[model samples]
Target: MLRVRQWLFAASFFVCGASLASTACPNFFVNGSNPSIDASLTTRTTEVCHTEYVLLASGVTKGPLYSAQHITAAQVAGADSISRTGSFHQETAIPAADRSQTSDYTNSGFDRGHMTPAGDESTIDSEKESFSMANIVPQDHKLNTGEWAKIEAKVRDLATNLGEVYVVTGPAFDPDNTPTIGKDQVAVPQYTWKAVYEPGKGAAAYLCQNDDSITCDVVSLNDIKTLSGVDPFPALSSSDHANPISLPLP
Candidate 1:
């Protein structure tokens, strides 16, 4: 997640708090500006922002990543998918090709995936916006559209059930050559599945799918792996777990 205050938001900060806050959330982010908070989890370099559902890929430091749309330094056509606050970012090589130049997309056979996926966003606009060069990772198309997408959907439901969710996601590698995006048409994640949570009732949850292709058991497991916490201030060291976030007043 990210945080920022544009000229349009200049007066809102003082009316409320010093700065907006957000954390590594459970859902995919699009047109991502800046959440009020930052995240605590850390991976290597660039891939940091490519974390599961959050972006902390600051080249200079290791901390919660503001939306590339929020920071001025992070701007490029399709580099970031959104321009709302301007913090959207992606790491696209100008050539958009691998050394082979055949099509890094198919040559490797690993799908160019989004750490913070697009379909995982609430609106198509947001999804389209987050579809940037920075958020892509080499993933198995099956995993992305299959379980990975389910996991992301679960993250979104978590935000809905718990008011706001701070999510962080990325490849599960201990370390490896951060995957590159070859000159292949960017793949959009398929929303074949979904997850729902009713925290107001308790810690109950459920997962559903649009297609009869994936399994329910595995989807829940992956969702748990990526998002298993109740942190109100996820931006503060990722250790600040509060009561499950509360949903917006109904």
Candidate 2:
């Protein structure tokens, strides 16, 4: 069923109301509000910004807790003309001890999955930035190339159809027993999620396990918060968080 265990926790870490506009990289978020992570779940995090996306890179996980992007019809059209150059590399801005190196995934079984996909970038520089290890996670090869790819494509299609959309993609780790890869011990997440919000419309999320089973679900924004300990859409109304719109699955 591809289910994620629900964790009951306080919403103390959430940043909302008037303070949203002051969040770092506010432009990439919905209503100018950045996603908030539960304090208990965060550790040694750094905010890394790029031309097309922004992310909260976690030292503990050696990867992004979430990568956020603002997509528009114009950007999507522009991206169509750009060629993907898979130049994955470490994020130099992040402290060396906290950032992931390309060598970590060199012989690892998992793929260097991108949170903000290169296909979403409109310019060559943006596409290159999308390959930063800070915006990556250890993902199952099959899941990354198959279902996850379709999900990314669907989000791009939605942006084209809806004119614009806000997206936040991230990984969810089991706090008690997160697996690791390479000398850096990059945490391998148990699940990966993507939340999408259309201005003046509503929001929804897609949740999938990081396994070869290929199962995934369309869940509410609130469901994502409970599973990930991060509210991807802090500016959305309670009603919007509670109700999830249908999204096509792979």
Candidate 3:
């Protein structure tokens, strides 16, 4: 059954309150710039700004081409309720023709992988907004349930230790045109990449295969920019860029 994941962690810092005070989420979308990179294939794309995260959606791909968000341990804590907030739903903000339908993943042997995970949102609205199809990608079920999930948890752990974090995650479509799923021809990404930045500390990037092998590696942000042309946060200081981070998932 598809259900929300539970999180348990100890606060190294003082728990000032039961939840994070409502504050503005950080803008990680390169100064509110459009997130589209591959314009040739992305004929109809839109930027769907949710409460906590922003998604660059592609109608051609039937899914989000990219997503960005601010993550914090306290925010995760506040959102991790015993009950799930929302089920999967089509995004009405975009035209129906420009959105992926719930039926797209049905019996497709793939999972509706969330770029900005529902668990990362601190409020019901944000959590519910996460279910919009514009923020989903067709990913291998094994990877979704395995290493990717582990990596997300580890990110939360890092946020807990570091205070706050910014992340940009998206699919890496094949150069030879990715495979399709469902009748809508939703593109199945061959690989996925996640860019992470923590204020005052350092930044790291991770690339992982979308298969069941659980093979993922850290790379340089410039490498990602060169390969994928995705410069998630342009305003970030250059000094914060760190060498390849080796964070092995348990």
Q: Which candidate's TM-score is highest?
A: 2
For all predicted structures, in order, the TM-scores are 0.39, 0.92, 0.81
lDDT of 2 by residue, 97-175 (tens): 9988888998899999999999999999889999999999999999999999999999999999999999999987766
Clash count list over all predictions: 40, 0, 0
- Tens digits of per-residue lDDT, candidate 3, 21-122, equal 111334655444333353354468677778788877778778876788877778877866535667899899888777777798999888999988887878
Model 3 spans > 4 angstroms off: 1-26, 29-42, 237-242, 245-248
Pairs of residues clashing in candidate 2: none
Of 2 and 3, the candidate ahead on lDDT is 2
lDDT of 3: 0.69
Q: lDDT scores for all predictions?
A: 0.34, 0.85, 0.69
- Total backbone collisions, model 1: 40
